[model samples]
Target: MAIINCPFCNKKASDKSAVCGNCGGKLGEMSVEELDRLQRDKRLALGQSLNNHAMMSLIIFLGSFAWYYYREPETDSLEMYAIHGAMLVGCAWYLVTKVRLVLYKRK
Candidate 1:
């Protein structure tokens, strides 16, 4: 195994090791370009995660509105309508955010 300096602790580390022995930080035989690409990929993944969360929130709000709509003894109440309207607004917000993030990823 080739010996290299650990980026985290500057200690001698073997290229074959997955982590630094001293600082327990990730140690890999990666070039500068590869490292930058890895970081970029991570940021993209984070953006994707945000999109997922937004979609989930939208689904939850829509489902709740559906459940409230179909419940038995449907008495027309202003409060019920208000609550459903709020849920719809929440769903719209999340949907917009998810779409924006997805479009941003394409660019």
Candidate 2:
């Protein structure tokens, strides 16, 4: 049997399954409109999750910025390097997530 993503819960299930293993949703009996609605809901949920991640990344970036300014870490020091790394990673992650959201919206 082939494994496939369930339209109801986006979980792995057998292509031969009549019901989804994760969500216990009837797979074979669902109508086209129902499947379309479920897919849209899944897309929306993913977008919202991505937005939450973007918000968290922004918060991390801001926190790191504030910490760096407050401490005034010495140049070439471990603390300075760590703070810079965090700031860079957080900013990059936020930007990537935003871009992904945009791409997803276009779909």
Candidate 3:
């Protein structure tokens, strides 16, 4: 008899319906605590993904740094430039991901 937003997917659905049409999420009666738990689960999953990405970036940076030092290429050679660029990009990516994760956690 009423249109309500699906708690799991935020899609419009009939309150009488058994499940969300868009995401097939269960439409059974849910308490406020359950909704909060679902939201928290989503946030934690995203945070975990970001954390993994940050770690990968750090690994990439370390690998590039080690390669640069090991090769000891000429200062202006293409290989040296490439390795340096990769190191910078990895550092920047890690920092940005960490900042985003912090902001998301604050929210």
Candidate 4:
């Protein structure tokens, strides 16, 4: 294995390690250009995920309002249905966003 200086602590380390053993800073396995590309891709993915969450939230809010205003005095079927649907959608959106964030953080 090739010897290289650790980016974190400036200690000697093997090129194969994914992170600096001394101070735990990342030592990328890929070439500089490849690492840059990966970072860009990650950023784009995060942006897309955030956008999806925002859109879902907006949809749920509007649906809730519509359901509330459309309710009749004697019947609440429509309102209940809309609320249930919105709750399900909101939960799904929350779970997906959380998972994406967790995966990105691990990488």
TM-score leaderboard ranking: 2, 3, 1, 4
Which lDDT tens digits does candidate 4 get at residues 1-107?
78866644657867777876888877766565664465577667777877688677767767666666676324456657767678677767767776776776676
Clashing pairs in 3: none
Query: Which has the better TM-score: candidate 1, or candidate 3?
Result: 3
Compared with the true structure, all predictions reach lDDT values of 0.72, 0.88, 0.85, 0.68
Q: Candidate 3, residues 1-107: lDDT per residue as tens digits? A: 88876777877878777778999987766654775677678778889999999999999899999998888889888998899899999999999999998898788
In TM-score terms, candidate 1 sits at 0.48
lDDT of 3 at 63: 90
Residue pairs whose backbone atoms clash in candidate 4: none
TM-score of each: 0.48, 0.75, 0.70, 0.46
Query: Best candidate per TM-score, number?
Result: 2
lDDT by residue for model 2 over 15-103, one digit each (tens)? 67789989998977875577668877888889899999999999999999999999999999999999999999999999999999899
Misplaced by over 4 Å in model 1 are 1-23, 26-28, 72-107
User: Per-residue CA lDDT of candidate 1, range 14-59, in tens?
Assistant: 8778777999977566765664565577667778788787878777
Q: Is candidate 2 or candidate 3 better by TM-score?
A: 2
Best-first order by lDDT: 2, 3, 1, 4
RMSD, every candidate, angstroms: 8.0, 4.1, 3.5, 9.1
**lDDT score for residue 44 of model 4:** 76
Candidate 2 — which residues are off by over 4 angstroms? 1-26
